[model samples]
Target: MEQLLDYINQHSSSGISEKDFETVKSYFTHKKLRKKQYFLQEGDICRHFGFILKGSMRQYTVDDKGAEHVIQLAIENWWVGDRESYTMSTPSVYNIEAWEDTELLMISRQDVLELFQRCPAFIETVKMMDDRNNIANQRRITSSISASADKRYTDFINCYPNLLERFPQHIIASYLGITKDTLSRIKRQLLQKE
Candidate 1:
């Protein structure tokens, strides 16, 4: 709970007051997920939004051919959930799975709404997060269409160096819209240049 308070203090612009922090803490439930376990499955309503305290998770979609497409990855101190589902109580199109054994501080949608009502400052933080996510998705789409695979890999590495360390090569390749073989070759070329 102290860690969560500290996290809110550091990341949230308006910050959380001690009293408000306690209220926020009271709303959260601790949860654990083993590697490959899902926090939310496709077609289910994402009732909870999770803040990662430990380990990592990936939100992905599987095609009819069963190919996984990585959408987002959340590590410690990051938020994870299907925003549309959590906000609207609709079915989720993505699956959120633990990439490693994970611990999360989770709060239900109702609790989040109540918190926002009580702590108006939290609304600013959520809006900021939404804006950042929108920009990131737009950048990703633009990069996919306009950049070379090598450039995409380089940009991805530059943007998320730590994520490369936490996630598998195949997952990274998928996120960059490249095949594992292509990623391997790019790595070799990069190593040779280095």
Candidate 2:
């Protein structure tokens, strides 16, 4: 919770007040998940928004062919949840699973609406997050449509240098929308160039 407060302080026009923070903090509940445990499964209504205080998770979807496609990785200080599902009270089409033992601060959709009503600083935080998410989504769409496999791989490496060391090659390949073999080939070709 302190981390979240600090994040808001750093990003907001004026930091949140003690009274506002107190009100905002009450709406959140702490929870922990073990590795491989799911926070949300496909077809479940996403009721809560999660703020990762520690560890990592992946939001993904499995297709009819049973191939998993990663949508995003949520690390420390990141938010994870199906915004569409939460907003609409519809079933989620994605699953959010822990990659490591994770701690989260979560709030129900109702509480979120209340928080927004009471805390103006919280609205700034959400706006900043939304701007970042939009830019990322646009980059990903452009990368998928216009970039070559090798270029995509290079961009991924440059953008998330640490993820290569943290996640398995297969997971990274899946996130990059490439086969494991293709990832290996790209790595080998890059090595040859070096």
Candidate 3:
């Protein structure tokens, strides 16, 4: 959990004293999940907010036609959760699943609210993370509506270069809102140009 503390300290403003950091840390519990394990399932309550200590996870939803649409990917040092369900105590419409053997530090909704109240610096930290997520989501939505498939794939590759090697082609295609065959053609076209 030393890395977790380091991440907080680095991201947080000077308003967070050591005591505040300790208090925030105390509320979290550690857990591990195997690859293919689920952190949250559709229709389940998302009880916890999680920080990935190691490995990766994917948040996605399945359509009526049974196609999975990737919502987001969380990697090491990133946070993952269903904010609406976790905050409101409702069922989640999405599933969060481990993409690899994963370690996480998780805090319950109650504890998260308590941290926000108790640690002033945590407010900024949380807001910063949330802002980044929101911006990324907005960009994805805009791209989906306005960009060509090849352009969207390029943007995805540029934004998450490491995922090319880390995730399977189908998952990457799903994330870019493209088919696997299209992704392959895009990759090949780019390679030919290079």
lDDT ranking, high to low: 2, 3, 1
TM-score of 3: 0.95
Across residues 53-105, which tens digit of lDDT does each residue of candidate 2 receive?
Answer: 98899999999999999988878888999999999999999999999999999
lDDT of 1 by residue, 1-194 (tens): 77777766766887888788777788899999999999999999999999899999999999999999998988998899999999898999999999999999999988878888887656666676778889999999999999999999999989889998999899999888889999999999999998
The C-alpha stretches of model 3 lying farther than 4 A from their native spots are none
Flag clash pairs in model 1: none
User: By the lDDT metric, which is better: model 2 or model 3?
Assistant: 2
Q: Which ten residues in a row have the lowest lDDT in candidate 1?
A: 120-129
Q: What lDDT score is found at residue 125 in candidate 1? A: 68
The superposed Cα distance between candidate 1 and the true structure at residue 123, in angstroms, equals: 2.1
- What is the C-alpha local distance difference test score of each model? 0.89, 0.92, 0.90
Backbone collision tally, model 2: 0
Q: TM-score for all predictions?
A: 0.94, 0.95, 0.95
Best-to-worst order by TM-score is 3, 2, 1
Worst 10 residues of 2 by lDDT: 159-168
Which candidate gets the maximum lDDT versus the true structure?
Answer: 2
